[model samples]
Target: MISKLRFNTVVGKKVLMAVTGLAMVVFLIGHLIGNLQLLWSGAQFNGYAHFLTAQPVVILIELGLLAIFLLHIVDAVVLLQGNYAARPVPYHTKKWGRSKSKRSKKTWASTMMMWTGIAILLFVPFHVWHFKYHNPVASARPDSGQVSPVVVGVGSTGVNTSGAASAPSKEAYDLALQVTKEFKNPFVSGIYILAMILLGLHMYHAISSALTSVGANHPRYQTLIIWGGRIFTVVIAGGFLLIPALILSGLIDPAKTLATAQAANNQVAQVPMGVGK
Candidate 1:
């Protein structure tokens, strides 16, 4: 009987949502760590990007992530619909309801979960297209050596060991420079900051709720679990927010960084292919 209820019941759906949501939260932490590399040199960040793309399993990983993300979204929608059906009558007042016996766990974050999740859904594709598909280097300042020479066989795999300033070329698209340039735009920066805020709100409730759904309930550890989730929420959201904030404030200069990347690429271009090998 226990096995029969695993996937067919509302409890089963909540458990599935909890597991998938937690998986994504873990992915977010790893992604934040990788993005923090932007605080370093463009060459370093681009090298990291190059390494990721060069991996044979990258596509598989992406497909798997996509599957998990879609499943999470679908289940969330289903659960939300189920909730509406269960509560056909709307509440008269927007105030919180509580009794002497039990306190309500509802907060602003929990209340807005669906909306915030939808916003994040809209954000991910645009982000992927902006960084992954668009060639910002093509629109870069060519006169300032922001453009690097493209190698026919080799992509941006060339590491500029020279300490000179240069830009990433179409072949290797200086991703770090691209990031700085995009963030410098007021609209882009604003959108990213807003998105991170929504992510924080979503995560605040999600972590605690997910744990409860997964049967992690225990009076002894409840407070610790809730606080731990909040800390995780702040770190993930705050770390992402810092990037655009720094770029827009002129702390991470795009022009100088691009020139350095370009100079490195230019030097690498002049060297004979087999010389380094």
Candidate 2:
């Protein structure tokens, strides 16, 4: 049975699509958790970022995720094309089925899946460009060859110049601060919130659909599964929406939360060669 499965086959494509889509959902949950660290402190978020980037396997994981994303896109296009070819005549007046015996599982989210998916696809590149490649904070820092504080050691304490013990200063990339600055911009925050809404729509149907495709469609538990998907959609989407909303509302003040930068020369001079290790 496994040997007979191929990309040309419909079942094969659905299975691949289901697997890839589920993989992305897992990634989204993990990503949201990491991003939420921004609410705590810049030191905490930067520490989390440093831990991930410091791993040698991080590059490999990124490459794997890219492959999964591309595969999901290609499979979706093939399925869509096949669907159109199978039904050459578009429906003239589609209506939701209301009969109890034969109720339609269709939803607004399901109907607009392609549109939401496209919007998310466009947003992904812009997000990556804005946060990953562009760093206003780093760019503004002096050109001196000083190692930026990446991650602070957990529970570690260091003495200030006055020889008084203090919480180790986390003066690295300051991504948490940068995230605040970006979200405070009306244009950037607006785009982010809109993209999150579309993402919620896409996931609303996708979660149940992916589960069903993978054979989790037993009649006795189908309803339960669908409702669970709905709840998951709200939590993930709402969690993301709260970040920018809080920033814009002046609730998460970066000035009081982030670690202050020490003098440039002192920072560069104090950083050990084994930093971020």
Candidate 3:
């Protein structure tokens, strides 16, 4: 029986789906926590973002995440194709609930899992483009004849006035600030918040279902899985929501915050020269 199942193509696809889905669930939790830093303040969020790209270990993790994302997408396409192939004939159904109640009784959230997955896939590239690729606000150019400012403690990846490295640019920072400023626009902010809510809904089902698909469905620990899903959903979604709320409230203004810090640094630089004279 075991060998027969192993040889089955459907079984192989199921295993692939389970593994990739679970990996993505873990990534989502980590990403949500990292994004939560935006709620504390602009400096805090920017520093956190900077730290992620600057660290070697984090860079490796990001590569792993990219791999997982690709694997999940590939598996999803394969599984979807297999599912369609298995049901090539269209059945005419007069009534929706005429079939087995066992299937109908399954949670609606779980049934809609594929739709949620599609939504997430659609959202990700837009998110990456907005925050990472072509980031306009974070780039900085050095003053004439001065080397670019070395992002202190940024090590080898740090930006310098010379602009030798594509280190986080002042342009990226300004872009980030401008993006946040848009949150003040009711329509834009509303859409962002709604997208986050959909993300939460997607995670809520995906987390526990992925576990169950991976042989964690035994009755002995099912309750724990359910509670874990709820908690994970709340924490991740709740934390992310705080960022938009704070931005809309004007509690975090990236441009103003950066300008203030730069002014203070300039004042400190001049103070020592005046004292010596």
Clashes of each: 11, 1, 23
Cα error of candidate 3 at position 43, Å: 1.8
Cα lDDT of model 2 by residue, 86-152, tens digit: 9888899865674443556788999999999999999988887787655422321122234433322
- C-alpha RMSD in Å of predicted model 2 compared with the true structure: 6.7
Which candidate would rank higher by TM-score, 1 or 3?
A: 1
Candidate 1 regions exceeding 4 Å error are 1-4, 98-102, 136-170, 254-277
| Poorest lDDT segment (10 consecutive residues) of candidate 2 | 155-164
lDDT of model 3, residue 75? 77
Assess every candidate by TM-score. Answer: 0.80, 0.79, 0.70
Candidate 2: deviation at residue 131, Å?
0.6
Number of the top lDDT candidate: 1
lDDT of candidate 2 vs native?
0.71
Q: Model 1, residue 16: displacement in angstroms?
A: 0.7
